[model samples]
Target: MRCPSRARRTRALLSALIVSVFAVFCGGEIASAQQEPSAPQPVSAVQLQSAIAKLGDLDYSARTNASRLVRRTPAAQAVPALIQAVSEHGDGYVRYRALVLLSGFNDPRAKDSMRESLTSPNDRLRAVAYSFFEHNPDRALIPQFVTAFDTEQGEFVRPAVARALAAAAAGDGVEVAAARQALIRDVARGEDFFRSSVIEALGDYKAAFALDAITSVAKLDGPLQDDAALALGKIGDKRALETLAAIQRTASRQTQPSIAAAICLLGVNCSSHESYLVETLKFTDRNAGYQELLRAAATGLGALGVAGHQEAAASLFDVGIPATEDSTRAPVALAVATIALRSTRLMMTLLEQYADREKAVALLAEGFDMLEEDLDKERFFAVARRTYWESDGASPRRVLMQTLIGTLDF
Candidate 1:
């Protein structure tokens, strides 16, 4: 299901927010991607096999160097070897790494290995398979996903299953429709963690069918209510405005920022909600533990900016360009960077129409600055390149995306 244009603005914003928030609070990788460096030259098949074997080497450096060689090998040679390693490697880590590299190839031959890996004894492999299906949705595999939904119990793996099912539900077919209903059922009655997973994926995919169910969950003053409200916003149906407004008035202070964001996303009474997010971000009492609130506000503003909220982008530039603290600046920079990268046409229009070009570019640079690791920058730009190629050839966004790539490569 395609989101209304407004909801599409939040697409990449949501992904970036999740990555930034997790890194800030949980100390996790920011925007993780199973990316590899550009290939140098083709290696002999024997040499490639040796490198693949070293993927499971006991020495960390050996494994690391082996990954580089394997990744840099041309896909014609690397893909088949990776597929073979995924199937027959003695070490589970080697198998997992092989599958990850295979995903980058975008070759159809890797599908069987990906499908079989779903049943692997390794939890990590199963998680990777679910992620693979999420990106490569196959109607033929809907039954397999349904089975995984029923039986998969790994904490991390289950969410991947939910994401895959939600993505598959985006297709047109009776089986897909059934899969959609089952997903809503899971959201309604699944255990706490699982429900959260399903709800998030539904929102991420902008599944319109789950609106009423998500709205009902929003009305209840339960733990899932916030997630439900966010999903409703992402679904982008204005009909949920009344439900969102009601919850906003009575929700706890900590949750209001998210509700406000959801309300803004619907493009109704957005200015007030945007103001509320700014106030929440500028809240001064740091010792009282309001960092979560700040992150929420930053994420919300990022969504607004990406959605073509010129005012929201202005606010981010003002607050983020000069900010120093990681807790405060990192999320803001991410918001600004997303606006520049994901909504290139809109961002370019804003910069041209307004006078914030230099400052906005500076803030955009700050976003990259936050990505200290070379791997993280590579993943971020890799995503940018994919998005650029995927966009319409004649679109202004495509042109601006190319400009962004050159401007930000430093």
Candidate 2:
């Protein structure tokens, strides 16, 4: 070949120089030339400060964008700055937004900030703090919440405090007796504001010791009665089941569905009502009232365990798989999943019968998503895999299997 041109030689020299510089800076390991460069590390502190500052921007869009950005910050570095923003820098709405973002982080430091907010002169801040504790309850904070509820003078904050106390009390390792006494005292004080929440917490804690008290509430007429009945169902004690049955037997049309649902969820004998549940799925009018009934009945059937009820499964598949409406589709899919968990064979049968495998798989996926226990989820996945393999990668079924495999990884 002829001697390389001067331009080519110069280009070669510059390329070698760049590679050497890169190797020197990057610990002498030559990076892959084909690979894309890594993204720049977020300047956590600067980003946090900038986002906090934008919370007060006059434009609503700017404020919302800032809130979103602040929420995306690294929790480890953002907690301190967010606490400062909530405590010192922001107006009522800004502080509220900051506190909301702070709640997403599972940092112990955020607790102290929340506790401090309880004493702030601003009612809105106090309310937000209580709401945080309500949804993110801690077992260790039960006493503090109880004490706060007693001393909190503002009417607006009292309900929030009660809700927080209930949530905290529901946690394991809580002083159950003391928490129950506190809740009962408030209930007896006749403040209806937090009575339902307290009942819910009592059930959540499975405070079997409070069965008698909860039953007493369940006997009362009105909204509290329904709350108490649901709480009793959640408690799942023999007495609670009997109490729910009693409510179901005597409840008016308006209240019967809820009590029935409670009974089903408690794993009580709901065989007598199974027919009605199946019937609820058959209504095709799509009226709002019928939709609500469909959802409640479908969910109740799932809670009752749909393993042997081929009829129920058929009804759910008929309504749910083809359901274009979200309201009807969600409940029906959930019911199907619940049943499938108990009997994977039934789900496979339904899948085999349905002409549209993609829609069927999507529906099953929705149901699978509702499962909370890891073991149950894994079992569902195993069943789906078996179905996939048994079909020998056939069309329609193959599509379902592929979608299921993809979703499982996610």
Candidate 3:
């Protein structure tokens, strides 16, 4: 045991063992640092159940936080629990929140839950059901929606029903014509709130046939006036220009942004109107009244971005660049990303045209980060991913978009 050669051999082996252990530990750290993040572990059954239960928490912040946690659950794992909660949750509010969360998944499995909720006694649940169908329009549901629209007395629920009807009308299939007429009548009469909703849907669907009805609404002096004007512009019919311009001249400051946005959408005096929108966002005194006005202007810019206005994208960046607060910056970021995601070419061209391309990319990435719902963020991600793969691999725009999409963690 005391022999010199044995002692030397023992020391060498121990030293080698220590080196091997150190290498393994340090190498793992290095590999982890370089690797893409691992897929999140599935939430345990108990944890998921607890989170689902919290969906109905009395505290608003608590409920919101719980919602965020449940939404982050992988769709494959979350769908079953969500469907169950939506279907069998004892609490009405929990059932409503579960359905709302489930709708975000947009899974075919949740369709039955959503359909059943269409007749739910809870007005909020009924509203969410109508909203789900608004995006996932089924011509088959048109007759049922028509009946609901006639009978739905809940103010909030009726507007959603109106939107669903408008969506069904946009689809190419049976009963579309009937859906269209129902939607028009909905705007022409019905409660102001319901009519406002139908007007919005017409604008969203670009129902040029509803132009006469929307124009009449635009001429009226009230809340629907702005909604109808915006709808007219979305229809892209130059015929509405005279009406929009006339409204702008007499519209109050609060209503002016909506009118200006409509005029810009029609490509008439866009520069002036665009400048006006930018000016609206530039106000330093953000009191409650100013905040309301700012939100309105932000919404206008979002509409413009959706319409693929490159200049408006630049303007969004211009407004977003200096904003420090997340609340202040979120709308601007969302507007910028909305424009960029419209098309790969538009994104590239818009960024290249911006004063600072680096900041443009950063802002777009930030916009992706600000998407509230995981499903919404996923949609934008899918669009960005599709555009990236479709473009020439060697194109600079492709490279730029790839970089931008890479920055999106959602």
Candidate 4:
């Protein structure tokens, strides 16, 4: 399709741009080490906020971390600029960062913009808007979000509304029973897509009203099973443990990984089925579930915080690589690698070349275990690893791996 061709050219252009810009822009990295400043820069808080508000175009010339400096200025000023970017920007990356910056702020206007974005005809724009609204409460807009779900023609945008409404239902407590009933009705009739989004929206909600409903939905046929299973994992209540354990017992090896991950996250600590991950790793299903188990294993390993944890994650990472036949395996490996390398520089390199959706895709975890501290590092390594793994025999990752092995040997 014409769209694919355009995206290929854009990615090629962007990759070239990243390499050329890195030396000129990123050579001076931000040091996390605390230091007492000798003198302050000339920019005042007011002036800085003004500059952030006035900048009409995306500063593509700035380093990859430019958005952080912009965010640190002031939310009152930054929110308006970000709202404008969502309304007008041409570049998806720029719009994405602006929204990321907006996520930290608590301006009332942002809620309106977010509401509008939820209903935006543009799918990508709607995605950006929902990303910000996900965190930080915006309760009054639940009705708006719910309406968008049934009326909107944009396939991508409708899900965001469902999620936003679901989050609102969890946070705002407005007509919660009615909302629960509506979602339950949909689930009963086999509206798996809407039901999944609704369950996902109810993350961390321990209310008795929803728990029984979610559990019952999990028992249903079709994809809602996975959705309910994932939601139960997010709730992290002990009540779901037995259900998850049963699910893990009966689930195909492919489905078991997700069930395990859900259980690990939602089940009571490392107590319930902690060994579920370890027991399953020995099998090789090669579907998305195989990757899910690796991810769940990495999470469990990270949580276990023992020598064996690292060993288990590393071994799983090795098996996951060499890229499985199904392209979905790439993101699966990336997530597992992320869990395996949490808090280490190993993850920093993995996220660099990460791209989403079009053509060859790479998946990443934005909030997986304190990734923000070393976000650029994660991006750099992601790019470096994927580029190395995908190219001919000679590439950055292979050469780097060789150097690392030699050093370890020495």
Top model number, lDDT:
1
The number of clashing residue pairs in each candidate reads: 0, 0, 0, 16
Q: How many backbone clashes does candidate 2 have?
A: 0
Ranked by lDDT, the better of candidates 3 and 4 is 3
TM-score result, candidate 3: 0.68
Better of 2 and 4 by lDDT: 2
Models ranked on lDDT: 1, 3, 2, 4
TM-score, one value per model = 0.71, 0.58, 0.68, 0.54
Q: What overall lDDT, based on C-alpha atoms, would model 1 receive against the true structure?
A: 0.70
- Model 2, range 258-361, lDDT digits (tens) per residue? 57756655666555566666665666325566654565566545544443456556667667776676567666666676566656676666666767656666
Q: What lDDT is reached at residue 348 by model 3?
A: 67
Query: Native-vs-model 4 lDDT?
Result: 0.46
Candidate 1 lDDT by residue in tens digits, 250-340: 9877667768878988988888899988877777224347765676677677667766787887787777666666566666776676565
Q: What does candidate 4 score on TM?
A: 0.54
Between 2 and 3, whose TM-score is larger? 3
Poorest 10 consecutive residues by lDDT, candidate 1: 1-10
Top-down TM-score ranking = 1, 3, 2, 4
Candidate 1 residue spans exceeding 4 A from truth = 1-40, 56-65, 284-288, 302-410
Question: Could you tell me how far off, in angstroms, the CA of residue 383 lies in candidate 1 after the best superposition?
Answer: 4.5
Tens-place lDDT digits, model 3, residues 298-410: 65776776677766667778777877754446556655655544344566677755667767777676555433223333445445444555767677656655555444432
